[model samples]
Target: MLYILFMIGLIWLGWKLIVFAIKATWGIAKVLLYIVCFPIILIGLVLGGLIYIALPILVVAGIIALLCGE
Candidate 1:
């Protein structure tokens, strides 16, 4: 009975750790996407002669940033 309880406790702890790891990884991924990837993508779009598309995207991003400002 004691062994069974110990095993269950270990399983629960392991599951919680996995959940925490996933949440942490996702948060880091989002930060990288916004800080690093977004500007590179916008620059590429403009340099590739897609200014028409890039301009509207930039405007919408600006509006979102303004509205969502902390």
Candidate 2:
């Protein structure tokens, strides 16, 4: 009985740790996407003469940034 309880506790702790790790990884990925990838892609779109599409994307990103707040 004691061993079963111990096993349950260990499993719960492992699950919580995995959830935390996933959250942290997602946050890092978002930061990299916003800081690095977003600007490069935006510039590529403008240089490629896709201003029509790029303008909408830029507007949406700006709104998201404002809503999310730093």
Candidate 3:
């Protein structure tokens, strides 16, 4: 019947639209993670390393200054 054929076509169109929407949203999420999240994570790692290196040197210098003063 013609009505059944029309219904099938409508369902197929709806399915295609949903697939396109999901793909678009996934692509946007990937771009956001790469452009924004990645840099923030990298900066955090660099800062963490800097702090880890600097704190020990600062403590050592303080100890030397205290021992030499007295």
Candidate 4:
């Protein structure tokens, strides 16, 4: 019985750790996306003459980032 309880606790903690790792990875990914990828994408779009499509999307993203403070 003690072994079973120990195993259960270990599994629970392992699951929690996995979830935390996924969240951290996602947060890093988003930060990199906004900081690095967006600017490159904008440059690509402008050079490709898709500003009409990219402009509003960038504006909305800017608003969201400003309001969310992230």
lDDT top scorer = 2
Candidate 2, 1-70: lDDT as tens digits: 9999999999999999999999999999999998999999999999999999999999999999899987
- Which run of 10 residues does model 3 get worst, by summed lDDT? 50-59
> Can you write out model 1's per-residue Cα lDDT over 1-70, one digit (the tens) per residue?
9999999999999999999999999999999998999888999999999989888988999999999999
TM-score of each: 0.90, 0.77, 0.64, 0.77
Better of 1 and 3 by TM-score: 1
Q: Mind sharing the TM-score for model 4?
A: 0.77
Tens digit of per-residue lDDT, candidate 3, span 1-70? 9999999999999999999999999999998986788567656766887767566655675798689966
As a whole number from 0 to 100, the lDDT of residue 69 in candidate 1 is 93
lDDT of each: 0.95, 0.97, 0.80, 0.94
Q: How high a TM-score does candidate 1 get?
A: 0.90
Steric collisions counted per model: 0, 0, 0, 0
- Name the candidate, 2 or 3, with the larger TM-score value: 2
- Top candidate (TM-score): 1
Model 2 misplaced stretches (Cα beyond 4 Å): 67-70
lDDT of 4 at 17: 100
What are the root-mean-square deviations of the candidates from the true structure over C-alphas?
1.0, 1.9, 16.2, 1.9
